[model samples]
Target: MKERWVVVIGGGAAGMAAAVSAAEQARYLGVDCHITVIEKTHQVGSKIRISGGGKCNVTHVGTSAELLEKGFLRAAEQRFLRSALYAFSNNELRALLQQQGVATTEREDGKVFPVAGEASVVAEAFRTLLQRLKINCELHAPVQAIKVHGQQFHLITLHGDIVADAVIVATGGVSYRHTGTTGDGLRLARALGHTVVEPSAALSSIMVQPHSLVALAGAALRGVAAVARAGKLRAERQGDILFTHRGFSGPAMLSLSRDVANMQRSQREAVHLAADLYPQQLHDELEALLLQHSKKQGGQLVRKFLQVSPIGMLLLKSETMPYGTIPNAMVPLLMRQAALDDEVTFATLSREHRHQLVVTLKQFQLGTVHNVSLDAGEVSAGGVALSEVNPKSMESRLVPNLYFCGEVLDYVGEIGGYNLQAAFSTGWMAGKSAVNKLLTAL
Candidate 1:
């Protein structure tokens, strides 16, 4: 009998998992199966090396289908993810890592990290697993074209032509192009009759214009709530917000970016983002405190009252106030109103420093984003439409024996470990299902 073969394109987390699962399944079936992982980059898991700022948040501890489902953009896509995520939850992946000599730790936010806290370690874990399974990995082999004939798929690569009974496209999205995720997989999938969602940067930082917030760059506000509004719909997230030289980043901004991207593309209108610097406090309580402080610091410049809020202090500037003096009585009223609604008058931000404060807080708004740079993003918002693929097997509905996993699909998740976990689960499902189908056919 001829040896069965499964080809996995792109050796990221998804491709690696798919190849391994298929190989393992074939082995159990007493069939000699050749598993080939073709990687465009010189090394597999190149994106893994830089993920989580090199910590490589491998997966999230929130294994509940509901929590994981919240991370995806589409309802059907979220439903499609249930089977795979439940099949291979965070605990299962952790155990797999431990078995491969990679110890992991969970952060307070439920994100799991390798003890080494280096993405390289996680990459090595996958590499070691593939090595042990004797999976054939052809690195630096970019697939230029994919041609389907009958039940087989032919990959025209930079090296040469390669054929397989089953093919899995896990080439990932356009984000972090330096990592080799340059949308090749989406192009290939499109050629094979799959609809490719025009990709946009997700889980990325935003760039705002004409602002001196650069002075406050690197300041981080925890439990900050960001709300993006597009017409009647609104999406919000409460997390840590980090000020960057270009614009805003950290979990809060990344979460909001998804909605910002969608609203920009769909509505053709500029999206508005409002941030609540203090989400935990009630508006009335905050107002009362501000009022009390105003009485205590009566006659003091309004800027002096802003010392109460962490975010307020960062926006204060000396030039905005001539004598740097403000009416103390106005402090409580402004603070209370600002807390209730992010929209505040310029005087409320800093009475003494009214001009700068108003510009910084009340009027501080960026355009609805012309585009998000993919090179700096953590993931892409869109990809091959989910309807064209089978959730059970991660196989293409139009092309038999063709499968896709990872960022290649129109599934994207927020910051944390949800995206990586999705990739692993989907890849595992695709591989196992393909193997099982092959066996049953034989």
Candidate 2:
């Protein structure tokens, strides 16, 4: 067999996996090959080092395949991601790491991290594996330009020009530019006859207006939020809402960031988030409950109705009843209206006032958020269009011997280890496909 050189760009999760997989495939086929990983940064897998707050969420712990797929919301259809995921599922990924002496543990929500609870360990394991395989690992080698002539790829880097029989571009997306993902893949794909979607922020925080939310900056509400655009509810997600100093963050807001980013780009419109602070009951049900509580209590203020902690009840729990998690902003707004006479109490509220108060309780306006930070997101949402790349192989349909995987691709999964899983699966597929295609051609 001929000696083929496979070059992988970026050196993040996807590039590292691709390089390793290609080397494994070459060794298995008894084919002579040189696989090199080109990283622009000082350290490869820098993002992995910082992921999951330095814990490195390697993959989702959905032991079952169905639950694992659900983590990939608003992404390429399962039809597209099916083969890669099934071939290298969550358990398989964990087992592969285990073989390398890196054990992982699952969290309450199914996010899997190293048992050691440090991302650097996972990166080190990969580094040790590459060293064992004698795969070339180059750092501080930024890709400046790329071109293809005949069947070979010419990759111009800060160091110099390096030609390869095949190239896997896994340069990631625009998020975390400090980690070296500066939308290099998108630009490179565009330059190579691929359609590049406009990149934006995903898993990011939004900037909200209205003084009420601004006041309760540290408040966190455990409930559901309905995203409304043009006065119509577009989507709804249930999770913990984190109130940030800038605006809104946490799982729910970050999950809806894709739609919010689209709205910002397409219509330049601000969307309203109708937060159900007490999502356990419907609006009418909550209204009736509040009215019933008001009637039962004789001249008692809404606040003094139950003996509960001041801030925790208002912000955290909604378990036993609507006693807590009422959102600090709504406490004053509804109380000021529900109060009657000099003594402001729930019992003093008339039927009409109680009904209005209940309505507000069911749907507390967290206010309108206009923008989500692009650079602050966990992942960037746009990249090389899927149609231009073969999902099964992670190879570019338009550019021969050129491939893409990970955040460089158009599909961006939600938080909670889905993105990492996709990176591994796609890189696995790309590595095998690239090696097989080149060897077969020879």
Candidate 3:
């Protein structure tokens, strides 16, 4: 049997998975093949090592349908990810990690992480798997360019040139340049006649125009419903939101940042983000409660009224506002926004004032969003267009024996474990497909 060479251009999550899957398939089929993973940085899985603040949210615990509905926002992405995600589901991933001696735990929010609680454990698990499989991994050797020469690929790297029978490019995205993902895969894909969509930030914090909310930095609201509106277009997300000194973050804000960023690029108008502090409460219900408060606690100081009255007690007992009466700090701000003074009592509260308070509470505007930081994005939103790749196998539609996966493909899942799971599944598909193609040719 003739020995064949397989090369993976990146050593991140997708590249590592591709290498492992290819090796497993080759061994199963008794193919004489050698696999090499070329990483430009000094380490492999740099992104995985620092993901989830070092805990490494490995994947979301759910079926493919649930993940598609919860994690993927766009219909096109859901359709493209259907096959790969179902083929290598979350349970399959967990089982593989468990087999490698890495136990995983699931959070209440459905994020899965290594029970060891160290991201290095997940990275090390892959390293161990690669070592056991005898796959050659070359670090600090970046591929400068890839050239096809009649049934072979010549990969020119910093160290030397290597020829391979098949190539998998999983260089990830341009965000996190410190991790060696400098959009090399997109460039590589473009050179091979694939369309590369312009890349931008996703799952990133939105920097808003300076506003009163800056004073409330570090304040977080639970069960908030946020909507990002630009022109006639709008994007909505529901979850907890954290106020930043300059902007907003947390699950809800990060989930909609990509759309906001794209809207900012397409329009000159400023994007406005509005939040409903109590999304579960109706406007009429809140107004009726306020009316009752005014009638019952007529003589109490306006500032102190909500603290001791039915409104506060009602909100406290509600399961949604788990943070305990809206962060005593925001009450004053809310009052100020309603044009009420500190000393005014509920007895003197005008109907106009009551209506203003309801408006402010029901539709609190964060501010005008100026930009979504690409450098700070957890994962970028664009790459080689999905239209140019085969969704079933993750192989390039125009190039034979050439494949793409991970952030290199044009799909950005929401925050949580969706993106990493996409990387793993597509990578496994690409690797398996490449080897199967080789076998067919042989």
Model 2 C-alpha lDDT versus the unseen true structure? 0.78
- Show the lowest summed lDDT stretch of 10 residues, model 3: 308-317
Alpha-carbon runs more than 4 Å astray in model 1: 66-70, 230-233, 280-302, 310-371
Candidate 3 contains a number of clashing pairs equal to 0
The C-alpha RMSD of each candidate to the native structure, in angstroms, is 6.6, 3.1, 2.1
lDDT of 2 by residue, 1-442 (tens): 5799999998888888898899999999989989999999998888989987899988886643563467766445455677778867889888889999999998887789999999998888888888989999889999988988888989999889999999999999999899999988788888888899899988888786664556667877665554546334366666777878778887888888877877767764567776655555566666666666666765666654423422212322245643244554545654554443335577567777667656655556767766788898989888888888887798899988899988898777777888888888888888888999998988
Q: What is the TM-score (0 to 1) of candidate 1?
A: 0.85
**TM-scores of all candidate predictions against the true structure:** 0.85, 0.91, 0.95
Displacement of the residue 13 alpha carbon in candidate 2, Å: 0.6
lDDT of each: 0.77, 0.78, 0.88
Model 2, poorest ten-residue lDDT window?
308-317
lDDT of 3 by residue, 1-442 (tens): 7888899999999999999999999999999889999999998899999988899999998889999988887899999999999988899999999999999999998999999999999899999999999999999998888999999999999888999999999999988889998999888888889999999989999898766687778988777777888898888888878899879999889888899989999887779998877677888888887788778778988778554322222442354534445666777887887889988887898999888878888777788987899978899989999998899998888988999999998899988989999999999998988998999898
Order by lDDT, highest first: 3, 2, 1
